[model samples]
Target: MEQAEAQAELRRRALDYHAQSPAGKLSVIPSKPCKSQDDLSLAYTPGVAAPVREIAADPEKAYDYTGKGNLVAVVSNGTAVLGLGNVGTLAGKPVMEGKALLFKHFADINAFDIEVQARDAEHLIDVVAAIAPGFGGINLEDIAAPMCFQVEEALQKMLDIPVFHDDQHGTAVIVAAALQNALELQGKVFKGVKVAIVGAGAAGLAIAKMLRALGVEAVYLSDVHGVLHAGRSDLTHWHQPFATAPAHWTLMDMLADADAVIGVSVRGAIPEAALSGLAAKPVIFALANPDPEIDPVAVKRLRPDAIMATGRSDMPNQVNNVLGFPFLFRGALDCRASQINQEMLLAAVDALARLAREPVPEEVQQAYGFSGTDGLSFGPEYFIPKPLDPRLRQWVAGAVSAAARKSGVSRL
Candidate 1:
């Protein structure tokens, strides 16, 4: 009864929080002053024409005259919202607005949340490509898997600006970074560890690709049906590369002897029995939100030696995508990158790993409501840096920008 009342209170507070404002979470405010007649003229009609003409002559001048360099379009089709599943495009506006808020709050990037009524991947691709010129970068969000892969790929090829799917690569980057640090603490090497991922959706597939880039050869992926083995006829192209050869391998078989397990699937997706087969000092990231694959408390009881992370803020080592997307786009937009490539993503991963090892700043400690850096050190409990760490803006973003320049992807 108490739990139910608590949940009801939370629901009421959330609704009130969103409803109390200007009806929604976002607003368009003029960046320039327009109090006087001359200011108005410069802001719009006559004086604006000068810069307009320059922009017309050279499209690159849009960055000089307008807010184009710092603008990002947070595009979503509402096909797959992590916890909510397929909430319609209109229904997904709040989540996108929250993402925009994160961009502004964390990295000072201006983001416009665009909810597109796209019928499929092709439609979303077309809509985003059409509006690509207005944004410095496109942040693909909440679109379902299989389709998300298609949409992101098409937009990346069709548009010159950075087109990133946050559900995929953003989650992948943070997970990779956290896992890298976790592995280092556990005395495991990236190339030597065997990882079993329990979801073959956008996050899972992307995590697999990211880990592969970091030099892990033994990656096993599974969907709802079972482990994605070579004999699975229903496997998509995205799932095939990560498939194991043995046809009859189950989730238990995949978990057996694995050094790490990452769950991007729904709650209760992983059975408690599966933990019995894991290698010693296992690294487990139960990233299913609201509820994890298995309870962290349960994991603690069952395997005291395990290092665990979850998507919940209440948990230590929360594998939050907030740590990745804001600074990533900040760097890409600052550099005017042609696209967000593998090198940039790896740079973010590397930056995050190194940042975790450094001492937590006093500002960061206070931001997370911590009194001091007692538990927030470079250890199993805090392998990933807190999302509120201000250093992330400079460290991760700068590394990404430098890599973009080095990789010859930067237009700046």
Candidate 2:
């Protein structure tokens, strides 16, 4: 009864918070002053025409004359939103707006949340491509798997500005960073460790690709049909790359000898029996949102030697995507990157891992309500840098911008 009441209170508070005056989490304000008559004329009629003409003559002038360079369109079709599956466009606005809010707060990037009524991947690509000129980058959010893969790939090929599906790559970057630190802390070699990933959706597949690209050779992925293998006829091209040769393996079989098991699936996806199969001092990243695949407490009981991470903010080593998107876009926007590529992603992963090993700043400790000696340090419990860390802009964003420039992807 108490639990039910607590949930009810939370629901009420959330609704009320969103419902409060202004009615939404975001707003548009004039970056340039528009108070006086001269300012109004310059902002609207006469002066606007000058920059408009300049942009018309040379499209690249849009960056110099307007906010286009720092603007990102957070586009979504609402096929997948948070832990709520297939919430539709209208229902997904809050999540998109929250993303916009985060983008603004974290990296000072101007984001406009755009929820489109896309029928399919092609429709989404068309819609985003049509509006691509206005934004320095396009951030695809909350779209479901298979379709998301298509939409992101198509849009990236079609548009020059960075087109990123944050659900896929953002999650992948943070997961890689966390795993890097976790592996090192446990004295496990990156390429030597075996990983079992539950959930072959957007996040799961992206993580698998990233880990492989980072040199982890043995990566096993599982979906609703059990482990992905060459024997599975239901597998698509997206799933085929990560599938093993052939096996009658269950989720447990994958975990049996895994040095790390990452879960991006729903709650209770990791069975209690699987915990016993993990190698000594294993890394467990059960990152299903709202709830994890296995309860952290349960994992602790099963294997006291295990280093566990979750999607929950209250937990240690939280694999949050906020640690990725803002800084990534910040770097991309700053550099005028043509696209977000593997080199940039790898740079972000390295930067985050490097930041985690550095000494925690006092302001960062204070942001999370910690003080003095009650601060974080580099260890199993603090492997991933806190999302509130101030150094992220300098470290991660700087690294990404440099990588973009080095890879010859920077338009500037």
Candidate 3:
């Protein structure tokens, strides 16, 4: 098949898959009987008043009387979908459903994706904020940056329930984990490390913020135009935070002598020149999907001591959000988190890092179709744990719940 034909065929199959299962995921079921008059009264009428009154008397009792405690709404405007860019509201549904599926499968949490048909960021945030009272937590996904920052900040400040953007923080959590492991393997530290982050978009910005949160001594970022630096007249509001000594820096300048390079930009931005002069045994997470900024093979060939990770499944050390999200919300819902704070994000990152450091089971290797010969090492090719590692759910969830409790955000 020609390239266009193959692409068309794949799209056709994806549509077929969705059409085969109409109405998307999540269907409400009547747990109480409606077959008899007495059942009707108890389930929907006068008899329901007792529990309703009790719950009204004590807000905390809502967890026992309703699904309020175990449910999450994955809210998004669909301004960003995959790497497809802004495809609008209707186009993002399947991805939302996929999020719902992962939530159920990975953590047994009841999640529904709420797609706001609003044409602007304000409308989406308003809709989510108005409905926030009904859910235990909100998981924001696939919205673009700058605007996403505004929406998350607004919702977090106003809503009592936890609000999170999986793209920003989910990617951050895994990268943090991989970096922690990679650093340990290299006998290096996070502070005093020169970090180059390619891509000024949501994931890139979030990863930078998280690295700063985790105590990175120095940081740099590059957009399509080049590096984000101090007083760069062309820099956007989001890019200003990572600005360095100069007004602007080229991609190669940013990468030279860097201890770590995080590629959240498009494919092939970092040619071999940019990869040169990286610190010995450099940690590289080429996170661009489908194709990373640097070819992994070329990277390893050029720098034998370098550690390599990407967002691709075929590569070792895949830092997929599948490593998180499912279990991250599980903890928030279980704890009845009133808001997703920096505490929750940090907790997930630490838990994920530690979990990635654990020994991989033989079955886990078998599931990945590996020969089971690779020792459990948290380094270049082994920085992240396999998706099938069973302990992920408990480890991530427990830490989030603990953070929620300690942070005074947990109702449980």
Which portions of model 3 show Cα errors greater than 4 Å?
A: 1-13, 23-26, 29-39, 234-237, 371-377
What's the C-alpha lDDT at position 107 in model 2? 100
lDDT of 1: 0.91
Question: Can you write out model 2's per-residue Cα lDDT over 1-412, one digit (the tens) per residue?
Answer: 9988987998999999999998989999988998899999999998789999998999999999989899999999998999999999999999999999999999999999999999878888899999999999999999998999999999888889999999899999999999998988899878889999999999999999999999999999999988999888898899998998358787778889899999999999989988888899999999987789999999889899999899999898889999999999999988999999999999999999999999999998888778887688998789999999989999999999999999999987
RMSD after CA superposition, every candidate: 1.1, 1.1, 2.4
Q: What is the lDDT of residue 246 in candidate 1?
A: 80
**Which portions of model 1 miss their true places by more than 4 Å?**
372-375
lDDT assessment of candidate 3: 0.82
Off by over 4 Å in 2: none
Return model 2's CA RMSD, one decimal: 1.1
Q: How many clashing residue pairs appear in each of the predictions shown? A: 0, 0, 1
lDDT of each: 0.91, 0.92, 0.82
Most lDDT-accurate candidate: 2
lDDT (Cα, tens digit) per residue for candidate 1, span 184-231: 888898998999998999999999999999999999998899988888
Q: Could you tell me which 10 consecutive residues in candidate 2 have the lowest summed lDDT?
A: 244-253
Superposition TM-score, candidate 3 onto the true structure? 0.92
